[model samples]
Target: MRDAFVRALLREMARDERIVLVTGDLGFGVLRPVKEQFPDRLLNAGIAEQSMVGLAAGLAATGRKVVVYSIGNFPTLRPLEQIRNDCAYHGADVKIVCVGGGFVYGSLGMSHHATEDMAVLRAIPGVTCFTPGDPAETEAVVPAMFQTPGTCYLRLGRGNEPHAHEEPVPDWRFPKAIRLREGRDIALLSAGGILVELKRAAEKLAEAGVSAEVVSFPCLKPLDREAVLSLAGRFTDLITVEEHTILGGFGGAVCEVIAEAGCPCRVHRLGLKDEFSAVVGNQAYLRHLYGIDGEAIAEKAMALINEKRTDAGRNP
Candidate 1:
């Protein structure tokens, strides 16, 4: 996904001279090409996250498309107030790209973990959040961020996630959710960097002779209510999964939609409980400890489907 972002940024730079990239003393190896191609456009703000964000807002005010990049919390959490007041409030055309979302930083410790980024950004008015499912979606959404004129947050994972898109979906815009499978029994909605696991869970459910549809939710805020409602109408049971805490994450957004639309489907929100992640070895271990792995997700989804079927039979 990092490679895809660099590739897309290079392409966007060649096409538009006004496109600028700024990093808060990070991404030296990852953003080298962008620096070489557009030397004046790229700036390393030297560990000053707050100033880096302010710089982007200033550049945007002067008619330059600016993107501020850094690892996890420093970019989003540290300069959060500046991001909210300076960027979102003014509706600045600055794109904030965060790398290593959720527990991807793992042993680097919880301070670097970006579990609260989604909920934080979602609270800021006029900020658009984009959490792509894979490299293909990453390639698609990154370039679109340049064209979009507002404060946008891009949640990028550290490595390969499930290949949600069969091919390079460059023309694809970020939607509230994309239905990858079709079934009347249940619908599973997923968010953030771990979508590959969600798809695997869907396939496992299929092998068990249960029909499950997977809806990839790349965009969290300004959710596509119509698409969610349409899926809810078809599937009698709804489940939402994410790598972040269930509070104010993807599941929270889905709950809001279900309440507003008043969808009659039984809903289940599966994710991290309201708690801080422990100091674990890596992302995989941490996910297992938290019970958010692919196998765990599949198991919970399967159980819900079976329970719903039994209830239906009893009532009939």
Candidate 2:
């Protein structure tokens, strides 16, 4: 996903010379192409995330489209004040990009985990949040963020994420939900890197005679309400999956839309249960431990389907 973001960013930089990239003294290998092609446009802020964001905001004020890049919490959480005050307040064209969201940096321990990024960034007014599920979605989101005229937050995974969409998304628009598979039983909505797990879960459910629809929400804030309402009308059970905490993240966002509309669809959120990850390992290992992996998602979906069946039998 990181590679895809850079590739898209490179294309955008070539098309528009107003774009500038500022890094927090990291992502050297993955961002090599950008440095080589546009050396004058790339600046390293030397690990000072707050100053880096402030600098980017200043550049944006001076008619430059500035993008601040870093891994984990450095870009978002560490310099949130600067993002809120300097960038969003002034409506600066600053795109804050955070790589290694969720447990992508699990081996480094809890400090690097970006579990609450979406929720936190979404709460700030005038800040657009993009949580692309795969490389394809990442490719689609980069250009949209640059085209947007205010502060934006982009949450990305570490490199090597499997593509959920086989081909490039056509007629892609901001905050629109992309339905990858059509099904009747339930709708499996996912944000961020967890879409791969939900896609696998849907396949597993299909083998078990349970059909599951897979939808990827590349943009979290300004969620596709029309799509959510349409799914609610068709399916009785809706599950939201995300790599971040369930509290005020993807799951919370979906629930807000459903409840306000008085939709009867039951939403079961699958994510971190309002707690930090205490264990450290690879991304897969931590997902399994937190019960947000493919196998777990499949099991939960089956249980929900059966529960509904039993309830209908008793009521009838």
Most accurate candidate by lDDT: 2
User: Residue 202 CA error for candidate 1 (Å)?
Assistant: 1.1
Top candidate, metric TM-score: 2
Note the residue pairs that clash in candidate 1.
Answer: 162-196
Off by over 4 Å in 1: 160-162, 174-176
Model 2 steric clash pairs: none
| Each model's Cα RMSD | 1.5, 0.8
The residue-by-residue lDDT of candidate 1 on 224-244, one tens digit each, is 788888887887778887778
lDDT of 2 by residue, 175-276 (tens): 899999999998899999888998899999999999999999999988999999999999998999989899999999999999999998899999999788
- TM for every model, in the order presented, reads 0.95, 0.99
lDDT of 1 at 237: 75
